[model samples]
Target: MVAGATSQASAALRTYPIAPGVSVNVRSGPGTHFSIVRTLVAGASVPIYCQCPGETVSGTYGTTNLWDNIANGQFVSDAYVHTGSDGYVAPQCS
Candidate 1:
């Protein structure tokens, strides 16, 4: 390999896949009560910057209270993300 390629590969690995066939809502906060900031296209993959506890949700994965912070002010239910962990996959959001 090439320089920095390993890091790039590791970064790619950090991204988790969204649930199949669903256009998931990206909320401003970690709960359904939060306003919708945007919606993700089906088959979207997102890199989780952090995670936080919020309202529990059930989706293609399983029910959980953990929310994955994909970007600043953007969060999605962990139940919709395939992170291969039932718990926190990134640092806790502050």
Candidate 2:
């Protein structure tokens, strides 16, 4: 499990890192900041249960994508999903 956060399975998670070099962003308030999750890299798949579609959006509901919190084996959004030939997280787990 990740440090500061826990698995968001309880939440309606989404998929992220659908590709590489995409760099899924960890924002300070759902959007903006563009701070990396630190745990995820290109290809790292995460389940986004709580999504905040856009940075300017006011609420988390009515979000388009399935957003996951990669604090514990999770992912935020596909914004950083890999765009490589394979499109998957590297050094995969078991």
Candidate 3:
């Protein structure tokens, strides 16, 4: 029998799935309190570099205190993202 290799390295990022037909606002910071940087189209998949506790946001999925860092100085509320889990899947943003 051939042996399969296993890797222990953590993923550098995670995919944040957005619901169909729902546009999401991308922010300069982690919450609505921050200015809007841009908007993500429906069915968009973004790579979450990290996460952090931010202002609570309510969306189609529900309410959450987590915000996902999608790019350099960009963040989006986790309440609108289907992360396939109920908890933090990546490292917290510093």
In terms of TM-score, which candidate is strongest?
1
Model 3 lDDT tens row, 10-36: 355446688678999999998898999
Mind giving the per-residue lDDT tens digits that candidate 1 earns over 1-94?
7975677447635788899999999999999999999999999999998899999998999989999999889999999999998988787998
Candidate 3 lDDT (Cα, whole model)? 0.84
lDDT for each candidate structure: 0.91, 0.40, 0.84
Q: Worst lDDT window (10 residues) for model 3?
A: 1-10
Total clashes in model 1, counting residue pairs 3 or more apart in sequence or in different chains: 0
**Cα deviation of 55, candidate 2, in Å:** 2.2
- TM-score of the candidate numbered 2? 0.38
Off by over 4 Å in 2: 1-16, 34-39, 56-78, 81-94
C-alpha positional error of residue 57 in candidate 3 after TM-score superposition, expressed in Å: 0.6
Candidate 3 wrong stretches, greater than 4 Å: 1-10
Error of 1 at 17 (Å): 0.7
Candidate 1, position 76, lDDT: 97
